[model samples]
Target: MTDTERTPAAATGRKQPFDLGTGPGRVLVWFYGVFTVAAASRSIVQMILDFGKAPLAYVLSAVAALVYGFITYSLVRGGERARRTALVCCAAELAGVLIVGTWTLADPSAFADATVWSDFGRDYLFIPVILPVTGMIWLRRARTA
Candidate 1:
């Protein structure tokens, strides 16, 4: 058995690139992608249909969509800088969810409709609330690994 034959890559059959395509990253990317589309389209449609009805909610949804889009892109980019950017975005996302969730609850009349993070993302199965937390954790792990 030569040294080349005993390498980790050889033992593992092949060496896969360290990217969001690997392991939990794959799932995270998928979820972020879905949310990006969902939030963007929803906000666009809502704004077009009746922006005056819920300007705050609709604009917030659009902002959330942009954030999701950026995070998704960062994750797919898959590098140290991307990981750090994603981590920052994820923390901002969590903060947005908490702030908006509390605001909506505190003053129901302030929001004519629900944003993606409304009710702690109850409308979206709480994924908006949970995603950032998971993303932060994943980004931290990916950075170390």
Candidate 2:
């Protein structure tokens, strides 16, 4: 169906103000949830399997996972601070992926194992590399809308 013909009744309302965690926001929320689950699981597995092997990398992974979880929470909550926090978290996530991805590439021996940032998240189909960019775009759209 066409856009005009397919819209739901709730979407044709007079309450046109942007609801960041509703409608399209719901899709972002689902992605954030998935990221939270993936990051948390990876961190937990890394820590459990071999923390002593690469303490710094594993700890950073855990921190990144926690940050992802917090971002997920903030997106679902939907407020000024929540949006701001989401921005900051997305920026940090981008930075983390870049720095770690570069480092892992520059010296694979140092990592000695895979990380979310490794090879630009080749293992995760590069969603870790792409998510922050998409998040920043979404956040900006949400803010301006």
Candidate 3:
């Protein structure tokens, strides 16, 4: 039998492009999912109730939520296209974290409130900074040869 014929997915006709839902990929998916929800909820509430206080921070949080949601969806999709999309998103997320983190540090007055990426996610234990790096590495390794 061919390689595809030997796998369970092939038997089931699923034809998984790569097994991103297994092992560490699962963990990455979970984290991204949580981040998506957390950021969305936080942004929505802040925008609704206190937008005038920190519009920039709240908007950035909403943007972060969107990115996290897309990355999570891509990871769970389990295809080459999805994987590549997730990889790009993860890189963007990392860059956002670094840029926002540095801005928050360099100019505290610029933001009246904190964002998901502020301080490199110090409020979230720096997960925002670390997760993208982990995701990129996992995605690169998860690619088919």
Q: For each candidate, what TM-score against the reference?
A: 0.88, 0.82, 0.89
Candidate 3 has an lDDT of: 0.94
Model 2, 19-133: lDDT tens per residue? Answer: 5677766777787788778877888888998888887777777777887788789888887678888989989998999999998889888886677677777888998878888
What is the descending lDDT order?
3, 1, 2
Error of 2 at 30 (Å): 1.4
Q: Compute the lDDT of residue 124 as modeled in candidate 1.
A: 97
- Expressed as tens digits, the lDDT of each residue in 1-145 for candidate 1 is 9876678774767653458547998899999999999999999999999999999999999999999999999998987788888999999999999999999899989999999989899999999999999999998888656
Worst 10 residues of 1 by lDDT: 12-21
For model 3, name the residue pairs that clash.
none
Q: All candidates' lDDT scores? A: 0.91, 0.80, 0.94
Model 3 CA deviation exceeding 4 Å by range:
1-16
The prediction achieving the highest TM-score against the true structure is 3
Clashes of 1: 0
Using lDDT as the measure, which candidate wins?
Answer: 3
Q: Give lDDT tens digits, candidate 3, residues 111-142.
A: 99999999999999999999999999999998
lDDT of 1 at 79: 78
Count of backbone collisions in candidate 2: 0
Superior candidate under TM-score, 1 versus 3? 3
lDDT winner, 2 or 3: 3
The TM-score between candidate 2 and the true structure equals 0.82
